[model samples]
Target: METPRERWVGADAGPIVRPYAVTRGRTRPRGMDVDLVTLLVATGRTPGERVWLSREQRRLLELCRHPSTPADLASDTDLPLRVVQILLADLHQYGLVEEVPQAEPAGRSTGRPDPKILMRVLDELRRL
Candidate 1:
């Protein structure tokens, strides 16, 4: 049988550190809502001396210099989506990052669709 070290010694070996280790074994972001389309931007506040940031966290901050979505951040850093969300939540808690409010689409006033339009669509579906 091949030793574990020998088995993982080649270029084919996967990531050295697992995602759980990076997030300290936390599977979810704390008290923060994050979704694929949710926009995130840096708050322009620098981390204080007391703040301890991991390499991944620093990389996230750099990527958030401009408005970014969690999906984009994950893709850019080549990290898992959950890991990015957790790191972003930490930055958000520190006030180093903020969520950007999405604007309503142009030519739309209310969030709810018109009842009449919905009824018509339903009627069409029923006909089908």
Candidate 2:
């Protein structure tokens, strides 16, 4: 059994998906899976509907429309790269944002990370 409060915002605060929409996989062949911008925009129901986005989170949501890098977001928002990384992690967990995996340069191949690494990292970080 679950309490109403447990099922509320404290439980989660990610984008709300439409019933008929088939959710897309957030993985990529390269670096990391970035957040899904189109879905986030579509989830914002009304102009006045509050989504409880932090300033940086809002800027991140706006900037991720084109697969932005955390460095770029840090520069644009005047936030530290580490801080942006933290927020992005949170957004990704709530299914709001995803990591955009980038390929290494030609002749410079690094092995792709196991998806479990990302999942474990996210789970551990969420407790903070």
Candidate 3:
């Protein structure tokens, strides 16, 4: 008999679930768009009070109990950015979390770091 293809196993030897399964075949989120640094805050809903939330959504609530960025959430959750974004969107629809984009400083709003700030930091590092 031929052996089946190897399956992914976790540290506990549990079968690994695919990412797409978690999103229910969604490749994109349905609500507000999010960037890497979009801040998220939990709505502080207690367990058993949440209605029809997925495990990913619950985990997102726990992680965002303290203000955190989507990038941070992805890193901490070991999930892809898209997956986290989708979860955040779901939480948003349920009013379980809020998305706040990081405001860029007035002068640096054009997407480039100010050269003066970089020079100052370089000078300080050289002095140290």
> Which one is best on lDDT?
1
Error of 3 at 85 (Å): 0.4
Question: Model 1, 42-76: lDDT tens per residue?
Answer: 99998888989999999999999999999999999
The TM-scores of all predictions, comma-separated, are: 0.75, 0.43, 0.68
Best by TM-score: 1
The number of residue pairs in model 3 that clash at the backbone is 0
Candidate ranking under lDDT, highest first, comes to 1, 3, 2
> Which ten-residue region of model 2 has the weakest summed lDDT?
20-29
**What lDDT does the true structure give each of the candidates?**
0.90, 0.53, 0.81
Among all windows of 10 consecutive residues in model 1, the one with the lowest summed lDDT is: 7-16
Instruction: Decide which is better by lDDT, 1 or 3.
Output: 1
Which rank order by TM-score, best down to worst? Answer: 1, 3, 2
Q: Write candidate 2's Cα lDDT for 1-128 as tens digits.
A: 98655554343544433222211222231223333221222123222344456666777777767667677777887664555555666566555665444666566576455678789989999989
What stretches of model 3 exceed 4 Å from their correct place? 1-14, 45-50, 101-128
Clash pairs detected, candidate 1: none
